[model samples]
Each structure stands twice: as structure tokens, then as C-alpha cells.
Target: MVAPPIVTLLASLVHPAAGVLVGLGIGVAGGVALLVQTGTQPPLAPARSAASPARERLPLGLVGIVAVFATIGGVFGSFNVAAIATAEASGAGAASGLLLSAYSIGSVLTGVVVGAARLPGGPRSRFLVAGAVFGVVVPVLVLAGSLPVLIALAFVAGLATSPLLITGSSLVESIAPRRRLTEALAWPPTGVALGATAGSTLSGLAVEALGPQSGFLVTAGSAALGAVLTLATVLFLRGRAASADAGSTR
Candidate 1:
């Protein structure tokens, strides 16, 4: 009795660390790629104001990119907490390994599609909306009491997790200044840490009170929140014309 609740809470708090670490590794890789692309020393310096307008935009652009990333990390970390709490309550805690695998699967699927298709802003918005829809769907599956359904949901959930994140990372790369790209990448990892901690702690308590199914419901709600945030980010980015311009004056 006590074990389930304790485990549920502990899982919620701890599991996000896994994702945060994964995201940080990805950010570092991206920074390396950018470094290689530009043939510049990888440093966390701000761009000089006297540089070209595009160049000057780099530092602020990085900040914008970091903003998008923090949103992604926070959303996904919330999902992880929910997944862990629900699994613990359902006596499926041992099976929770599927969550990470599922997330990876989702990320790969999204990466392939995004990289392959050169979509405009409108299409990209649709893509993010679709991800949000998946976010809503996956937790609902977990709330249902079918083992097979939950397994399938795991894969779908994983897929959703990756694409949403990749889009955010891509945005950061596109807009952040060359000088601050490395540091901008660092922001996502820190955000992931904070997100993971909050999501886990909350989900643990929620599961303790309401049960596993309700815990999943809460998870679904958080996913919806993430979806809404992604949509808002898309709209904000679109309205601003470009990330560089939006963050330039700051």
C-alpha cells in the first residue's frame, strides 16, 4: 500500500532526470553540429553589437530558441511524471521502461518527417497541432485498463515527445546568434531539470490521492497544456516574422 504511493511519487520526481539528461546530450550534439557548420570556436559569448544585423541577431535569437526549448522540456517532463505515477499505481511499474523507448521512437519518427519535408509555417503548425493531439491521446490510453492498449500508447507517446522537442530545438538553431548558440543549448537542460522535478512531485501526490487512472487523466491534461503552449509558440513565432527580429532588441 505504502510502497505504491512512495514509488509513484519517487518515479515522478526521478524519471524526468533521464529525459533532461537526454535532451542535454542532444543539445550538445546540436551545438557541435553548428560549430562544425560555421567553423567557429565553440564558446558561450554574446555576439558583438557592431556585427551584421543577422549576426547581431544571434545572441537574442539564441534566447528565443532557449525559450522554445524550455517549453518543450517542461511539457515532456510533465508527461514522464504522469507515466511513472500511473504505472506505479497500476502495478505496471516494472514495465515503465517502455516510456523511454516510446519517447525515443516518437522522437525518431518526428525527426525523420521534419527533416525530410521542407514545410512552410502553416504546415509546421499543423504538425505541432497533430503532436498535441497525440499528447492528449496517449495518456487517455494509459487510463484505460487494457495492457495492449497501454503498450501501443507508449509508442505513440514516445513519437509525440520527440517531434515536439525537435521542432523546439530547430527553432533555437534557426534564430539564436552564432556566438551564444552553445549557451542557448544549455538552457534546455536546466529547464528539463526544473520541469522534471515539479512534474514528478505533483504526479506522485496526485496518484496518492486519486489512483492511477486519475493520475493519467492529470497527465493528459498536462499534455494538453503542452500542446497549447506549442501552438502559442508557433503563433508567436509566425506573428513576429522571424525569431531574430523578435529577440533582437532585447
Candidate 2:
């Protein structure tokens, strides 16, 4: 979400290829920082042997989580280049960063709020929040006559998207078994990346074949699909809870 705009800004001052290089450099730097930070964390308690995978069935709830996250990531990633291209079509290509910057600002604010105040409806509900808002906002980009409107809605998009990323990651900590936690935590991001790759391809082609305005349709459609996937997640969790309760009663 944040990387695209920063790169675009660099692109305008330098060249398009430079923008891509800078974004990759920032990503590598961030990865290194993340590794350093994780390495510094205190050691965890011993893993629970009960979490051994031989006897356990993969929880459908976790599968559902991966599906939703991947769906959301694809839609969100589609906008990475599509949004800038749309802005370019509007003759705001030079200032495309403004749209993405506002989106990041919104995400930052939401991060603070989510940290301070517990958002109602829990982690799974974030899918609904993100899907609905992004679905609506992306389609409306076609109607935006100026960059300011795009920026405003882009900020709103940030607010919508941050929760899906934050809450989905948070849920992994609670739902994954102690022994499998590291591997379990990985699925969401892996799904997200794969979906994003797909989205980038889909959106890029849409823009080239159709027009900049048509590119937003990719976002709108994908986001709507994400919202629908949330129902699967909800139902899976409910069924899991019921099964657990039934087992307990025995």
C-alpha cells in the first residue's frame, strides 16, 4: 500500500525504472530491519508437543482465513499500479504520489485507533470492512474529476484496508497451534503475495486493453469477491466452534 506512492514520487523526479529500483531497495531494507527486530525478541517458551501435525487435521477456519486474505491482497495489490495509471490518465501522473500518500496516512491513523480502541466485530469482521469500503471507493475513482477527490477517497481506502492486514495477522496468533504457529502465520502473507501478483497482472492488462477508468473495475470486482469470501470464513469459524462445543459435551 505504502510502497507504490513513494516509488511513483521517485519516478517523477528520476525515471520510471528508478522508481522500481527505489521501491525494491526500500523493501529489502525493511526486510533486513524486520529480521533484526525479530532476532532481538526474547526467546519463547518451549513448544507444546501436543501440536504435532501427525494427528491433527488442518482447521477449515484457518483455510478460510487464507482464502480471504489472498482475495483481499489481490484486490488491494491490483490498485498499486492501476491507481497511478488512472491518475495519470487524469493528467495528475506527476503528482500520483498524493493519492497513495493520503491512503497511507489513513492507514496510519487507523492503526493508531485500532491500537487504542478495540474495534467491534473482531478480526474476521475486518474483511467486511475492507471489502465493502474498497469495493465502493475503487469504482468511484472512475467518477473522480480531480486529484483531490481521488486523494480523499484514497485516504478512505487506507482506513478500510489497514484493518484487514492488522486484524488478519493478529488472528493468526490466537488461532494457530503453538508448534505450528510460525508456519501457520506464514500462510496469510504467502496467500497475499500470490494474490497480489495475480492482481497486478489482471489490473495491468485491464488498463492496457480497456482504459485507465476501466482498471478500477478490476479493483471493484476483486474487492467484491473478497467480501463474499468473508462469508465462508464466518461460516467455517461457526462450524468449528460448534464442533468443539459438541466434543466438549461428550
Candidate 3:
């Protein structure tokens, strides 16, 4: 939430490169702080015996979750480029900072609420709803004519983001085997990185070829794909559970 405003301030006061350097510095400091908190870390898991089952491959459901996260990341990447282009076209380049801040604030607020509340549904069901909401909200960004409108839509889009991400990670924890947990968890973030790169590159090209609004189309499409993948994953899991129950009866 704070990064955008701070980066914007530093960029305006110094140079854009300086702002980026400061952001990197802050990230490094955070890492250092975490590393120094060794006493707060959880105890290491017990070593597995040689006779234990070989490390299982990741489930298809977990791969679907990673894909959903990738689509979400694409939405974020496309929104960043589109927001900047739209703000610049409106002769208010600084407004992009506000737009991004609004997005971050919305996510933070929703995350807090979601953390405290006992939402009524399984992770998969909630994830499906969140994905659908995200997909539905992103396309409306293209209709934003004013700064406030754009910011509002950005915030709304952000509202669904936290739930989607939280549920995705939770689903990873639930679906992955203990032996493969670390590896499985890593894939979602990797997916996000890959998707962000693709989204930024594609959206940049789209904005250059068409207009600022065209970038939102990329986000909308990605979000829609995420929703579809989430549905398929839910169905796949249900089928797997049903098959397991039948086998157990036999």
C-alpha cells in the first residue's frame, strides 16, 4: 500500500531510478529482518525414512490453482500499464499513483476482513466466487472516463484479488502432500512471475497498437480465463473425491 506513494514521491523529488533503488533497498531490508528473526521460525520437519513413499507428484488441482494465480497476476500487470497510460493521456500522470494506491488499499482492507471473518464456504468454492468477481469487475475499468471512476473501479477489482490469492494458497496447502508442500507452494508464485511478465509485455504492445483502454481487455480476458480454470479445478477435485470414496467402499 505504501510503496506506490513512496515511489512516486521519490521519483518526483529525485529520479525514477532513485525511486526504484529505494524500493529495492526496502525489500532487501525486509528480507534481512526476516532472516535475523531466527527464533521466530517454526521448527524444521522431521526427516523422512528411506522406506517412506517417494515424493508424490503435484496434483492436477494444484496446477489449476497456480494457473488461476497466474491469471490474477496478469490482471495486475495489465492494470499497471493501462493505468499509467490512461493517466498520462488525461494529463495527470500523478493520478496513476493514486489509482495504484487505491488498488493496494482495497486489497489490504479486504485481506484484513477476510482474515477475521469465518467466510461460509470451502476454499475451492470461495475461490470460484472470488475468481468470478474479479473477472466481472475488471472489464468495467474500460468504461472509466474520469479519474475518480477509474480509481473506484481499480479498488473494486482489488477487492476480489485478496480473496482469490488467499484461497489459492490455502488450496495449495490442502491439496499438496506434506513431502511436496514446499515445491507445490513455490509453483504459484512462479506462475505469477511468468504471467506478470507476459501480461506486461502483451499489454504494452496492446496499448501501443490500440489505446490505453485496450490494455484492460487483456486483463479482462486473463481474469475470465482464471474463472474458467477455477471452475474446472473444482469439478476435477469433486470427481477425485468421489472416486476415492468408491474405492474405499470396495
Query: What's every prediction's RMSD, in angstroms?
Result: 7.9, 3.3, 2.0
RMSD of 1: 7.9
Model 2 alpha-carbon drift over 4 Å, by segment: 15-17, 27-58, 121-139
Model 1 ranges with Cα > 4 A deviation: 1-71, 112-139, 242-250
lDDT of 2 by residue, 169-213 (tens): 766666777656777888998888878888888889999998875
User: What TM-score should be assigned to candidate 1?
Assistant: 0.62
Cα lDDT for residue 89, candidate 2: 84
TM-score of each: 0.62, 0.82, 0.91
Tens digits of per-residue lDDT for model 1 on 30-61?
98887779555555545557654654444333
lDDT of 3: 0.83
For residue 220, what is the lDDT in candidate 1? Answer: 64
Give the distance in Å from residue 199's predicted Cα in candidate 2 to where it truly belongs: 1.4
Inter-residue clash pairs, candidate 3: none
